[model samples]
Target chain A: MSEFDLIGRYFAALGPERSDVVLGVGDDCALLEIPAGQTLAVSIDTLASGVHFFADCDPEHIGHKSLAVGLSDLAAMGAEPAWATLALTLPESDENWIRAFATGFGRLASAHGMRLVGGDTTRGPLSVAVQVHGLVPTGAAIRRSGARPGEAIFVSGTLGDAGLALRRKLAGEPVAPELWHRLECPEPRVALGRHLRGIASAMIDLSDGLAGDLGHILAASAVGAELELERLPLTSWVAEVVAATDDWSLPLASGDDYELCFCVPPAHIPVVERLSETLGLTLTQVGWIRSDAGLDVRRPDGGQLRMPARGYDHFPAANDGAD
Target chain B: MSEFDLIGRYFAALGPERSDVVLGVGDDCALLEIPAGQTLAVSIDTLASGVHFFADCDPEHIGHKSLAVGLSDLAAMGAEPAWATLALTLPESDENWIRAFATGFGRLASAHGMRLVGGDTTRGPLSVAVQVHGLVPTGAAIRRSGARPGEAIFVSGTLGDAGLALRRKLAGEPVAPELWHRLECPEPRVALGRHLRGIASAMIDLSDGLAGDLGHILAASAVGAELELERLPLTSWVAEVVAATDDWSLPLASGDDYELCFCVPPAHIPVVERLSETLGLTLTQVGWIRSDAGLDVRRPDGGQLRMPARGYDHFPAANDGAD
Candidate 1:
């Protein structure tokens, strides 16, 4: 059978049922009804074998990570998940592999209320490109340029577990199962992001580490920040790992956390805290936005702390793989 | 500089200015205001190096073809182009190459009234995946499943030049400049497609050759067709090539033509003819849909003609590239 035939058999039936999707996989284009007075939030991400994941990684994990990364962008924008299109390139058509991959992708898609609308299957080196479309009220999307001076900076959930897991995996050292899971299938805080929409002033997802992604918000907003190192939330395992290695930089600059870092006014802190309590998810205030020019790292004793690296970079050298 | 930095410098400013796009690059997600009562049509296409094009082909042509193919899907759906997201993977960061590519892509985007919203830049084997979003009136999209028996089959423009060009390029034979141009930059019939929205019964873009793509519409609509070999609209050069080789299969099975094929009722034939005159495009009625099951080709002498291979197959073996 042809590549198109394979997709029609294994992937076409995986989409969620939604009235908004007027037409789906069979057509040259998928038609979706965008409700009145709503804006569409769109983002695309490409994950390549040996670059974004291990070449020998599980196909199911590859599928999950591919969609999760793109959905995180919608979460950061505080948009309601709606539809997605996938462009998959493979070295060969493996029926079992495609089935597992579809299952992994379909499960996450159903949970988030997003439907697979259309896609293309091609033969090439293994790679997956996912473009997600979501909806938000017109002019109501939270952006990266709304932070102001004196606003509190916050992040949802713990950090650095994925980075630690990557380090251990690369070194062939023993790793905790939780850390491994974080490395393989990082959860996107979609619900928390949607809840924080009108509350947060500026927001960004931490795919490229806290320091770097927050730096993006600051640069866009024309502000700066002072992060209190001790206030950074970390799990017991991460804390222990950092202490054992005398390296606290992992939590500060580790990429692939996929948690949200946002800023809000001081007056809204109570409401945000109440939201945190209601959702039973950690929303730690790690820093404050300032009118100054650049980011500063501060110790609890009022001394200055040095940064290790800015974050993960796709083009560190000419021959390296992308993030 | 990093890959993100490269994108910020080169690609961020390439987006067209559109008020519907609330946000462009440099954000977690790009927000687009969908006009009330309009449905969004979306399609994605990926062009991998050495698979879709020669590994050493010009980057400018690669960039143009990448976006054009996705736009053709919108044209086939009778949707007005609106926005696009590009996920580009490159083996290395070549500043000059990137600048030319951006120029080629930006020119077509501006012409089509589509804005570049958001995308990812990655390092890997070179590939360009473009997802295009277009707008159409609610419940007005042209679908492949709407064709019926007794409708006349029509196609816009000439066919088989791209296929002829490919064959010449592979065999190290001399090719006409026009044929080479057609292979590199076949125009998508966006305006004509929009005009045919209410007139055509069923529509699809010719990507995987006429026979294969027309087969898709037949399978969806549960109908058949009879094509007249002598009635196929062809350029003088393609006719000469076919006569010299004593093979008409090139025009019948050549991919990458990027033309529109549709079925119109007998009553609408006059309207289509008027449209063709207005657009100065060739819209030749080459066949008719039938109640029978399979496609039949009739020669000038009323003799039945057998088809050649059913167009390009991505997985003919395990090592071939996708069309």
Candidate 2:
């Protein structure tokens, strides 16, 4: 396959078009419009073949997951996604792989009204880098440092299913179809994140699991959290396994959930709960913020569950439970 | 070195803080302000090691050239660059190499008043993908489709110095410091491009030499071009070599020139010429747009110069004269 064939997805057959994009592709640059009183939110992520996923995994899943991780960041910022540019590196130009990748990326982008503007496809080891641009009304973006000491910590949707699937796959065990789906197509919580601007004090997407991602909010806000072990929103499979083994790694240390972990002030709890009900999402109140700067996990018997004191690191140990 | 150390260029040690960036690194996304009445120009490019550059090339030059290519795209649109995001993949982290790379990248970014807003770092074969965002007044961006049949074609600076350096290095010949610098740190034509907004009918950066890059302008404008073989701006070394060997590949088909090739209407030619003089740049008038849809190279004796018909390709054979 020629480079032109792979790049055709942008100039001829990409998804969606926005009024804001004056020049979409095939230009030196894509010209975009940002309305007055709005801030542009930009997020970039790279998914390496062996580091992030198995090289033999479906290219469609690689496309979906690569874009989803960045969209999850936009969602955490309470921004509306508008455009994305991709930098794809491939060892060889595989026509079928490019088609399947475009299929996955275009479908998700069209669902959110996001447009693929411009990109460069080069020759190299397989890797995908996606940068997404979003819009939010100025002063309304949710930041990690806005969580007050007395705010309530909340999470939307079930967690750990993707992590469980990854663990199973790495262990050479057969994963259930539903669990595998969660790993391959973790949806970005865009709808809920857009609605969280006024209600949530601080927000972050759970890309690196609860313990590491939530720790960012705590450190940034100069507050702590006390989480209830039983209050976490978990799938039946993860919950049963954790309860039987007395292990919390599935829900706490594992990553790739793509769910939203947020902090809402006590005063806005009722409002956010109502909004979650309207959106038909399970809004679990798992914890509360504290004045002291530490995280405490309370067990059902009222004893503290101890874990390591760590946030995010650039490179982590292989078996640290984060893929 | 840990991933944290490699990614710290954005969070702590990168240069130049711009007022337009509201929230930079250490957050879910970078929040930026794009003033109304302006359009945002975006361009993304990836430089894969062993393909774009030798695997053992100086890491500092790799950083400089990677960002420079993306900046060249923004310059072609006559936009003022504001921010950039990088997604870097590396097989391993080398602290000294990273520091030198940051120094090279930071110096250029600070020169343009562009900020490093956010990015991702991961483990993989070495590759650097930089996406630059710029601002231009609404409807003022220079597009390749704007050129007319009667427009005069011009280019900034000399061409083929980088291509000569590459050819020499590959053939195990001595390369002068001046020519090697051309390959290592080719400057983007930002200064010349910014001043040609209204004066130029169409513009593009000569990253892929005249034959290929000019073909883009011709194809986009649906016009042909008549280029004068004697009028090409060539350095002393390249001129001597071409005169002795009768080889036109270096000046016509090689890539990585990083100069501006633009079209100006007959009436605006003098205006752009005077502006180039004021800017202290050598602006050479090498060609003119024609009504017919094919490229013609006229020799000094009035005969047509015959060469292959080709534009840019994602991947080409090793000896295509493009680096």
The global C-alpha lDDT for each of the candidates, from Candidate 1 onward, is 0.87, 0.86
**Which regions in candidate 1 have their CA more than 4 angstroms from the true location?**
A306-310, A318-323, B306-311, B318-323
CAPRI grade, predicted model 2? medium
**Global fold similarity of model 1 (TM-score):** 0.96
Q: Score residue B129 of candidate 2 by CA lDDT.
A: 92
RMSD of 1: 2.4
| Chain B fold agreement for model 1, TM-score | 0.96
Query: How is the predicted docking of candidate 1 categorized under the CAPRI scheme?
Result: medium
Looking at model 2 chain B, which ten-residue stretch has the lowest summed lDDT?
B314-323
lDDT of 1 by residue, B1-323 (tens): 66766888878866568988889988999998888878899999899987788888888888889889988999999999999999999888888888888887888888899888888988889999999999999878999999999999999999898998989999999988899988887788999989998999999999878887888888899998999988999999889887787566766778899999999999999999999999999999999999986888887678887553244677766423323
The candidate 1 chain B region of ten consecutive residues with least summed lDDT is B314-323
Per-residue accuracy of model 2 over B66-89 as CA lDDT, tens digit each: 889988998999999889998888
Tens-digit lDDT string for candidate 2 (A236-316): 989988989988878887778889999998889898889888999988999999998888899877889755534344465
Measured by C-alpha RMSD in angstroms, how accurate is candidate 2?
2.2
The window of 10 residues in a row where model 2 chain A has the poorest summed lDDT is: A314-323
